[model samples]
Target chain A: MNEYKILFTGTMGAGKTTAIGSVSEAAPIVTDVANTDLSLGKERTTVGLDFGLLTLASGDRIRLFGTPGQQRFDFLWKILAKSAIGLIILVDNSRSDPLADLVVYLDGFAEDLSVLPCAIGIGRLDTHPVPTLEDYIDILANRNQLVPIMSVDVRRREDVVLLIDTLLAQLEANTFGA
Target chain B: MTILRFGIPHLSDPEVRLVKAFFRLYSQDPTFRWTIVEGPPYDVLLVDESVSEDVVAGTVLTLTPVKSELPNTLERPLRSDHLEAWLKKAEYDLRNARLQPQPPEEQPIDEQRIDPTSSSHFKLRRWPPPALLGSNPVRVRMATLISRRALRLDEMAAITEQPLAECAAVVNLLRGAGLIEIQDLPDKPMTMGRAGGRFADQSVKQSFVSGVRNKLGL
Candidate 1:
């Protein structure tokens, strides 16, 4: 059995760590630190990376790598995106502009992950007054080509699993040329 | 019909696959009664091994039957040598059956040998607090060194209070991102450089101070 590597990349505080912890069967090994960086005025921060190992029921283990979202550490994201089989671009809707956040990450992918399969998770939309999924998709459509995008609570098990399943299906479709 | 029972730890994938294969192959025999008993937070395999005592303490192997006779009591100790021989033959296949982690610091026996509670001088004031952030070393480094203009890996080790390897790992990550520029002042005596050097920017200093404040709640 072969295991695939998946990556979770998004803005800071977008729940990358929470998502990994919720879905990972093993206690997710976390690399987190309180945000002290004044670069983006971040009060809470994840400077290095959040990595977790997930064992699927098929007995194949998939490694989930969560990269930092700050523009200063763009180098790390590029390196991590090289071997990434799929990308989970988490969007924070509670922030003023979801579309702007989407643009930043999508632009980053333009360099390293050209044509890589991506699934956008619109986080914090449940509490915030944000547009619906259709609105979110339309928001993405104006930018460039649209990928499989959905609103997800990164903290929930089912939502994270659904996002991964989408990514796996996309990978299979790509690999088999289906 | 020699029916023997086994108590097994968590079954590995390879072990389960092998068992299923053997079960399917032996299902053709009418006298064989291989039963799987799952109960009480443990899994047991009931096999009719002719050579009962042959099975080792930590293995699952196929047993060949020499006769057909169910022992009246099911709690009989496994005394089958025939099964043990089979285990020896299949031991290679089971090598990767379980995935064990790299040896932990302080082996189980070592932890047991040292009674932390009993050592009055060494007694921990508190269990180490839950990490405020996850175990990302780079973040820890940036969090720690963000305020400092210049930091040696040795200085980082001292600041984080972690071992050299951990400190090196954190520094390497920060250096990779161009967030830090490492200068090797090998000739510097006593590993002493000033704390919070002038090289750090106001932003980096503020970030570092905030991080320390958040972490220490000072």
Candidate 2:
């Protein structure tokens, strides 16, 4: 069976770990530590990588890896992203500036994003409705990047799967030059 | 009752009568008071495609797109449902703006007595004030859950199938907005053993599968 490596990256409190855990067949392996960053307002935070596995109906294995959210661990992001078939960038809309947050991920994965199929999952949009989905589309359009973007609650397995399906669909579309 | 003044500029007599007829239907409604005005100081201006630019210098809801996405423009061939929806959104937005925080000294203080020895100075509010609408779905779901019963962030995440981080963000936003009353959980010890934990895991997996099936229509 073929194996596909997928990377999920986002801001510190964007729910990458929960999203991975929600869809993985087995209990996800999480390496979290006591959060010293009080500014993040969370008691515990992912310090290392989170790993999960899902087997598709076609007998393909999908390895899900989540990078630690802090920009300080960006080195690990590249390390984890290596050989990954697709990227899922989660954006927390409730942040001070969500569009700017999206730009950070876009810039961080600049090389991989150019070739690899990528999807953006925006969370908390119901509350932070100012920078609408159209706003994100406009930003991507301005940057000359075309990708599928959707509102997602990562804790839902279906939503997480939808992101993966969207990425795969994009890859399929690109393969056929549709 | 809030009075919303409207100006329909440069329309024929029959068209003006049609607009007035639309307003008359909602005239009996207690919450919305609409007044058809001739000139300035109108709250909203509904202009036809041929209406000149210098008609009024205020909020304009045009029949067609004028220049670069006018905020309140309604497309041609207005529908009652669409008009009602737009007015509701306008009213909601106005209420939200009014509910925004004023200067500290000018802010109204809650009259509820506070316990000085409490760990946190803020008291948990039960019902979200009506002013707290149009928030993110996560926050709205969390509010609904909280309204039903007190819950922790994790519990809220599980119930709503939202990410823990997203749930935490929503909780923080609600707390910061003073729209939620946090109920402290009683300190309890873990009693579930390994076998129980395994069963709980299976249950969670089963529920997740069912949820996915339902969401995907599989």
Candidate 3:
């Protein structure tokens, strides 16, 4: 069977593991551990990448990979993003500087993003809606990349699926003639 | 000699070949300078009901709803007359939209010279933080579609199934909030010759985009 990959990256506590587990047929494999970074305020964090799996109707397989959200793990982002078909960048609006967090990933995966079809999912907009979606668009506009974005609670299986589907819609749109 | 590009998707290889043949054989109208592009950034796309959701701020020549005889519907069988008419219509509508009068009260805010109707593949710079336009179905649909791609004024109305005025309001709302952005650079007038495999297959990339969608029951 054929295999493909999609990478999910975001700040700590932004729910990459939850997003994957919500959609994965089996429990997601996580490298989460007791929080070493106290600034993050979370009890645990993924020290390594998180992994999940899904099987397509054709018997092909899609690998769901999530990068370690801390900025120190930036090197692995490029490595994990390689060979992946697309990227999903999640943002935690509740963070002190969500927009800056988004910029880090946008710049971190800048090379991969140029060629990969990507989507953005904003988490916790319900309680933290300061930097409206429009603010994020402005930053993206400055960079000249038109990425599909929305507010999502990755805990909901449908929400995670929608983020993936949004990326696919863009792919489908481009493949109109192929 | 300015060339306008048009994308005609969902057609089979034979049909594309026939369209190219038709373009070569028929060039009586010098005013119509259109080339066939496969993917996007075309001045217009001839769409059926299929890829309606994928549209972003660009003009599209679509068919009328089942026998309704819409003014600019690119009628079926891909006749030369229909093709010519639609291409002409696409150009004319774009010109017409640009010519739309600016409200006297609103100052001209040029965010890279907003054209509103250019068939460029528009992508959002960011998503809206909240729906200030309220939660009406039409407004919700407008937000969803616009967030995906920039819409031609008519496409905003057509795809959302709302009045043109309402769609414009949604765009204006987003524009007011600084949520809009033109994904492709504004068009520039350029010359081109129509000969020797002139119609270019630039792209169309969603290979199995629907795979995950199907598996997820979307």
Q: Pick the candidate with the highest lDDT.
A: 3
The docking quality of candidate 3, as DockQ, is 0.11
Please provide, for model 1 over B45-132, each residue's C-alpha lDDT reduced to its tens digit, 9 standing for 90 to 100.
3333443554333334332334324332122223334333343333333334323443787344234322212211111111110121
Write one digit per residue (lDDT tens) for candidate 2, span A40-75.
778888888898987655555678898888888877
State the lDDT at B3 in candidate 1: 24
lDDT (CA) for every model shown? 0.50, 0.63, 0.67
Alpha carbon deviation, residue A90, candidate 3 (Å): 1.3
Q: How many clashes (backbone atoms < 3 Å, residues ≥3 apart in a chain or on different chains) does model 2 have? A: 7
lDDT of 3 by residue, A52-168 (tens): 999987677888998999898899999888778779999999999999999999999998776576888899987885666756865886787767677889998877877786666
Point out the higher-scoring one by TM-score: 1 or 3: 3
Predicted model with the maximum TM-score: 3
Per-residue error (Å), model 1, residue A24: 0.7
Between 2 and 3, whose TM-score is larger? Answer: 3
- How close is every model to the real structure, measured as TM-score? 0.42, 0.48, 0.55
